[model samples]
Target chain A: MTPEELAEFRRRQKSRNWVLGGLLVFFAVLFYAITIVRMGD
Target chain B: MTTAAPITKQALPTDWRDFYALTKPRVMSLVIFTGLCGLLAAPGSINPVLGFTAILCIALGAGGAGALNQWLESDLDAGMKRTQKRPIPAGRMDPTNARDFGIALSVLSVCLMGIAIGWLAASILLVSILYYAIIYTMWLKPRTPQNIVIGGAAGAFPPMIGWVAVTGDITLMPVLLFAIIFMWTPPHFWALALFIKSDYAKVGIPMMPVVRGQASTRRQIMVYSVLLVPIAAAPWFIGGTGAIYGIISIALSLAFLALSVPVATRISEDGDAMKPEKRLFAFSILYLFALFAALVVDRVAAYQGFAL
Candidate 1:
């Protein structure tokens, strides 16, 4: 592959990773919130 | 431009960890959580060692059932994109080895529970395994969409087993806990099905979405979600729990209902359009964990003689 194609592949992979990372972060915060509420104060 | 070649050789994972993945760890977390609730809520005291042993046995039994489930569904797993990477399907572990491992663990766990705890607990554990491995995985999964609804009994048994381990008797409290988990399974599963409908379709499984279509599936999810709120709150209404638990129960149920109503009521031409099911799927995990945690915490308050 050319340098340009290699760079494009990396960029696409990074974007996919970012999307998954964002989802994990979102669910983690939601779980933590529920734990606090259930823990009471 | 160079095109990618399809690889013919599959590298198998030789590590023991690959075998462990056969048991669904995520589902077992809920089982352990509810089992702990059962142990905490019983009227009498249990030796801490014995109590821990019972919980361990329950986890092992649950895991064993999961392993057997994977063994039976290996072909189906291979077809589904989401599950195609499981150990058996991925060719990391042999299917027969998984079957043997599951059977061995199932017997060992049941025997240990019986000797260390009580026969009642052991019996419940055995039945739970049978219900999942034979009744649900083998019978119901390939047959109908109502599989989860009826087969959810296997998931619901942990608390009752825990209760029996401690009190050595069945009562309304444990049954109510069973009911809570039982009712929670449908919406929880259906929400997941909505997102992964293609996987189920590919494998020829009649999940709610694959068999009944999205609108009917959404309606069923809402119906279960609405039904679950009252069932979850039953402990407080019947005086099994206190004010604090009652408040949290109602609050969690309300949030769950709020999440489900939009999915059920949404109007769209595309079958896979609604994102609310995904939202509900994520929140449902939190909802069950909080509901049970509230029960556990409320019990602690009561024991300490505090008006919670």
Candidate 2:
């Protein structure tokens, strides 16, 4: 990869990683909420 | 000079937005709205947390189905102006990744729904996913002009699943909700199809306008539009919803049919814009949103001892 291509790739990778991390955290919270609701019912 | 050819078919790495695009978020919003309406309008109630989970599952399943549809129809999408900018067709993402992403979301949504809500809702969600991804996308869409008529059932499932999420079983009201959408879909989709007939023809998808000619397609749109009015009014007729929902649905359905008048009668000249079809298409979205919102409002009124 050229310098520009390499830089673009790095930017894309960083964004994808951050999004994936955010999604995982959201899912964890969701599951916890689901568990509490189920237990209460 | 010897130089290595680039191995990547994609011009750049796929962004998260590309993946989101595969979900067809605009359509997902409708699914989410209708599903929430069904949940809220049901006779009983649910915890807000559980209710949100059901809607989230419906949205995810819908997104999964949209992704799989794009993955399979990437070639067809590439041929059309409306869909050419999609992730796979635009070469922003790989088809394999899109397919796998769809499967993951599909599995996760169904499993979460079953564990979190109830198995009945989850099973319906599973069926809806399959109905869209495999039955509609893989089979009906390319094969017949009647594809939208049958495949529209896939979109109709969300509200019924939402109803079942609270009720935990099937009933006439949910079935009526499914039927209202099923009958409403042809006219709604055909209006859009009438305007974008060339896109279907270029891709050889056998849309009604391309197969039956524009006049026939318009007539069919009128027929479905007439049929939709009665079906839309049925929930009120059956005493499922109050006069509020009934009154709004009838008014909306009549307006929907009225917009079809010019579309049914007019012939398109070379330079003329298809304004009637476009207007009807725009109204169809609003009509559904308004109809479902009325249903929820009516339910609330009934719960509060005010609705007639």
Candidate 3:
């Protein structure tokens, strides 16, 4: 691949990884909230 | 720095969208809907967050199994026009990648379900993934005409798992829900197979219409459709559901039987159409959705202290 194309691919992959990481964090918070509620109850 | 030669582009490249498609989103939607209905229809209440987690796990588990099924059947899929464009079959993604992604998702979902909900729901989730990936995909699908009949159990587990997520115990109501979907699968799938018989025959997949001929397949579809009426009404009869659910079940089931009759009895000549099969196939999806939606409505009505 050309250098420009390789750079574009890497940029896309990085963005995708960020989205996935964000999802993971969101679910983690969800579970933590659930645990807190259960303990409080 | 000394410069090296530019690298050549690969023949095919896979993207995130290809990975997403491996999950078979359309099928996952139905699974999620049914699982949500099961969770809602259960006798007790669950934390909304926990309930969401349970449904998410069901979706992931279903998607994982779907990916694994696609991975295992890539070669077979390549031979069928309908499936030829799937990730693995299309050569856009490696089979190993699909397999590993599926296994990772399966394990992750099961573990999350155990942690967020309870082990019972998690265990059932695991069993469902195994049932679809190993039992149905690996063993049954290529072997017998009765593949869908038996393998339908895998798809039927989601609601039961969802119910257990809330109740933490197996009960007659959830089992009835399971049986409804289980019995609904054969007719639903066979209708599609009747229209696409050549696809299965070309790939040697041993689908009902391919192996038993269309006449016999249609007859069995009718038989299952007839049997489904009573089974669909069982929850209402047992007082597990309300009159609303009961009335809707009876109405939709009769409509299902009505649709099945022409498909069962009609003999197609040269240049004949597949209108009956197509209509039945489409109605079957709506039938399950409407029936399950009625269950949720009935539960909500009873909870609100309305006479149901």
Candidate 4:
């Protein structure tokens, strides 16, 4: 592949990683909130 | 303009979907369901968050074991038609990657379970993973015809683990739940084996029908099916469950036995149809789902102060 295609591939991969990382953080926060609510009851 | 060079195509990149498939999500669903039923049926209540954590640990542990199984059995899986397209066997993922992913998930789930719930549940989860990955996948599967008989215990542990997560103890009820699944596995697996005997033979996996003749395998399936009826009813007899579960268990077990009768009795020649075996295989899945659903329902009814 050309250098341009290689650069594009890396860009796309980084974006995918960011999305997945964000989703993980979202779930971690959600779970923590739920736990706090249950513990407070 | 300069002439463009011809571009070569490369293999598609492995995505999260391939990793998900390695976990055998379909199988994990049943494991989660049974584990949740065990949690729900236990005597006392747990915090919802902890309850969810126990079930999540069960799922992750089951997934880890599944990934490890696929990693170890990639060669045999490639040989079998049913499992040939799995991520490892299909060249979608590296075997080492699958193994590492499995181990990571297994360790993470156990640690989280210990921290969030109790160590007993985490320990049982750890054992279930090792039992499936090492004992069943590595040892019994290639060596013995009775692999499913003993290996079924790995699948049976989830509910007991869930119960322990709640009570932090093992009791007769959880053991009875474990026994029901343990007794049910042979008939369920053997029926599938009877129909797909060629796959096991091709892979050199010593499944019952491959190691023993079909006649013997069928007889054993019937024997287990017969035994499962009484074993399934034990929870009700012991006052762990109510009559609703008892009645459903009897009906389901009888249906399972009736389905097994033709498979056991009839002699199918080479090139003969395997309708009975196929039916039993299909019904066996339904039988377990229905039986466990009834258990949950019975518990819910009891919780609502209805005598059943």
Candidate 5:
């Protein structure tokens, strides 16, 4: 494979990782929010 | 190394992930969260184990409705970029399979809820699933612009169902919760429609913006936004919530109105200045979270004798 193809693949992989990371952060925050409300219950 | 030949297949592949996707987990999360708030707000106590089962059933019912919606709209979904990657449209699941799966879940969830919770909560869950899957998805969506307005009732039922789960009776507080969600839906959805207007138009879905135009939709959003303030504060006024919730409701309402007013006033010629619509859309999620969080906090604070 050409170096250009390798570079493009790496970039796509990085973008996917960022998307997954953002989703994880969102879920973590949501869980924390639920915990805070549940604290009193 | 030799390049492998592409495999040809007649039918789409399926997996657990695809089945999960059919349920629309993202939408169900919000439904479950709001229902939990309702359960927490009610006056009576429920068995913890039973309550958990009730919530799980509610989530499954919501998921069932969503799967049925996707199955019905699979064709239209393929035509729209936003929904083109959904399981059905992406060739990961067959429409008939999704239809059967949704119906099965719908029955299972309602039956389990009836046995574990009460018939009242279970019946409401059954109606909610039916309302969304059949009334909204099959009947209203393709036919009219007012679909979401009437269809919002399905989403509004969770709190009532939750309240019933705890108390086994309907009351003003749960109805107030229902009304809050009912009134909030249009503005919340219209804000999203503003950004995705073209998609609805392309599919002939007759969303408010597509039918009445962007300007009219913006006006309607502002109207609903203003209306939501009083409705949100009703619980506080009626003593279901306390002063802290009252203050939070007012503040959040103001923030929502502040965001929506600009969208209402912006001229279409000023292209994209209606970005406030999108801002309001994002804030709407936070607005709901804050209002419900305030309710839980006030209840806790009062229980602790921190208030008059």
Candidate 6:
């Protein structure tokens, strides 16, 4: 592949990784909240 | 000017935006809003964290259904002017990838809802995913003109599921909420179909306007609008909500019916802008959002002991 095409592919992959990472963190925090709330109930 | 060339999947790098586009975020917003109103309007209370989780699940499930729909109809989408720019048809993503992504979202949302909320709500969520993905997209849409009328039930479930998430069971109020959307869908969708009937006809999809003719679709829109007003007002009449919701419901519905008057009665000619049809289509969305927002406002008033 050309260098420019490879760079574009890397950029896309990096962005997807960021989104996936952010989602994972959000899910972890959400589960922590859910657990605490259910315990109090 | 850009060359008019064919797009192929291999030529494009899949981006997060394309993946996001597959979810039909605009429609998902409405589903999320209605689901939230149902949760807020239900008689009981839930933990704020749990409530957010329920809404998230509803939203994700909607996204999943939308992706699956696009996956299934990629070819049909390619044939139409409106849907040709979707991820699959635009060659930004593969159809199977969208399908797999849809299934993953669907399963994860249902499982999370069941674990965090309850199995009852989760069960309904599962049914909704199936209803939209299978029943509406695969079965009804290609086969019949009455597809959206029946398929509207799938969209109607979010509010019901939201209520059930809090109350853990179904009741008349939630059912009434369900009925309101169900009755509203025919006119809402048919108005859109009336204007875009050519796109549907090009793809051989049996939209009401294409299959039953524009005049028949117009009459049906009027008939459904008349039916919708009473249903929208039923919650107040049944004492499930206050006069605030009732007053707004009746007023908005009357306006909806008024707008439908022009759309239902008038026949369009070639090159007609279809302004009345477009107006009703736009107002129908606002009407639903306002209606549901009114329900939540009524609920809040009751909670504060200010019965209006």
Most accurate candidate by DockQ? 2
Q: In model 3, where do residues sit more than 4 Å from their true spots?
A: B1-13
- Docking level of model 2: high
Q: How high is the DockQ of candidate 3?
A: 0.44
Q: For residues B206-235, write the lDDT of model 2, one tens digit per residue.
A: 999999888898898899899999899999
Better of 3 and 6 by DockQ: 6
How does residue B123 of candidate 2 score in lDDT?
A: 99
What range of 10 consecutive residues in model 4 chain B has the weakest lDDT sum? B1-10
Which of candidates 3 and 6 reaches a greater TM-score? 6
lDDT of 6 by residue, B1-308 (tens): 01132453355457988889999999999999999999999998999999999999999999999999999999899889999988888777877789999999999999999999999999999999999999999999999999999999999999999999999998898889999999999999999998888999998999998888889999999999999989999999999999999999999999999999999898999899999999999999999999999999999999899896
Q: Write the per-residue lDDT of candidate 2 for residues A3-38, one digit (tens) a residue.
A: 988888889999999999999999999999989988
Question: True-contact fraction for model 4?
Answer: 0.05
TM-score of every candidate relative to the true structure? 0.83, 0.96, 0.94, 0.91, 0.84, 0.97
Clashing pairs in 2: none
lDDT of each: 0.83, 0.91, 0.90, 0.87, 0.82, 0.92
Cα shift from native, residue B236, model 1 (Å): 1.5
Candidate 2 interface RMS: 1.0
Model 1 agreement with the true structure over B58-130: per-residue lDDT tens digits: 9989989999999898888888778888877777666778999899879978987887788889999999999
Give the per-residue lDDT of model 3 (tens digit) for B1-308.
01121233223345778888999999999999999999999999998988999999999999999999998998888888899888877776777789998998899899989988999999999999999999999999989999999999998998899899999999899999999999999999999988888888997899988788888999999999999999999999999998989999999999999999999998666566899999999999999999999999999999988736
Off by over 4 Å in 5: A1-41, B1-13, B269-274
Per prediction, the TM-score for chain B is 0.93, 0.96, 0.96, 0.95, 0.94, 0.96
Off by over 4 Å in 4: A2-19, A34-41, B1-12
Candidate with top lDDT is 6
Candidate scoring better on DockQ of 1 and 2: 2
Question: What lDDT is reached at residue B51 by model 2?
Answer: 95
Q: What TM-score does prediction 5 earn?
A: 0.84
Model 6: per-residue Cα lDDT at residue B165: 96
Predicted candidate 5 versus true structure: per-residue lDDT over B1-308, tens digit per residue: 01111222112235456778889998888899888888877776776766777788889899889989998888888878899888777775667889998998899789878866779999999999999988998999888888898899899999889889999888899999999989988999989988888888887898998898888988988999899999999999998888888888889998999999988876465346556777889998888878877877877788888753
lDDT at residue B73 of model 2 (Cα atoms): 92
